[model samples]
Target: MFGIKFFLLVTLPFVLRFILAFSTFAPVAAWPVWSGIKPRNSRLATVAEFFNLKDRKMAVDASVWVRAMHGDKSAFKILSERCESDVRLTEKIYWKLLPFVSRLERYGA
Candidate 1:
């Protein structure tokens, strides 16, 4: 969970917008996000499963993403710790920004 202060009042803020872009459990096995605009897939769970399937790189990134989504405020710090070795900031940011960009395109400015 996270909080934001407004007018000196502390308010716990839940993430109101989150999108899991793709999953293996979707009805259409060959499509991304069931061809919907912004559907929530079982992405973290799928990634966890990927680890078992030997996709190390995607699994590692998804593990960090799962932690962050599940209220681990230090998840980003953990990712930074793996900077040069396991993760690239640009790639992570690009993936993270995708959902927001999609929303912008579907909606208006």
Candidate 2:
């Protein structure tokens, strides 16, 4: 009985903690929450880096949103490249950026 109690107290917690320490699957939503938070030396940054999206995507997307809204061509290109080149980036981002496409076309840029 003592051995069973010792194992449960000492070993089980460690095993469970290790197994659920972090997630490998990329998150599809809640960009704002994860963008600013997360401790230093975190796995979340690693996931972001692997996807090649700067600042875990959300922060940079905000910047892209501002520039694209103003009809910046380069920002538009960056927005398209983000959606097309990175499978991790969802089509929703592309749709959000589409509002500026007509302005760009009007300017003939």
Candidate 3:
């Protein structure tokens, strides 16, 4: 029938191409050729490793008051000073967020 002939014409090339593609890729899929390959380290990772120790020290120093808030007034004073400077500098550096901060303050955060 004409319908059967048309169906075969449309499907025969697609089935052949699909089978050929799978056959071509079978060897590539079966072999573990890239198992020995190692990825190169990024420059960012090296820089981060260099500063990681210093970052930890700075974090500990900055949080000294938060960790001992009730026990030490000096620690609290230092924390307040650092927080004021930190907020001012951050706002200056990220001018785009100035509006967002204003909105947050309006909301009483």
Best by TM-score: 3
TM-score per candidate, chains pooled? 0.20, 0.28, 0.29
Question: After superposition, which runs of candidate 1 have C-alpha atoms over 4 Å from their true positions?
Answer: 1-61, 86-109
The TM-score of candidate 3 is 0.29
Q: CA lDDT of each candidate?
A: 0.40, 0.46, 0.39
lDDT per residue as tens, model 3, 1-109? 4687665555543443343323333222121212211113323333233223222112337468566666677787677776675565444423422222322224555
- What tens digits encode model 2's per-residue C-alpha lDDT throughout 1-109? 5697776556654443332234333322322322223323435345455334443443356888799999999999888876554544443333332332333325555
Off by over 4 Å in 2: 1-61, 88-109
lDDT score at residue 37, model 1, on the 0-100 scale? 28
lDDT of 1 by residue, 3-109 (tens): 44441232211111112323322122122322332223435434333223322332356877789788797887776565543344334534543543423325665
Tell me each candidate's RMSD, in Å, in order.
16.0, 15.1, 20.8
Clash pairs for candidate 3: none
Candidate 3, residue 59: how far the Cα is off, in Å? 6.1
Sort the predicted structures by lDDT, highest score first.
2, 1, 3
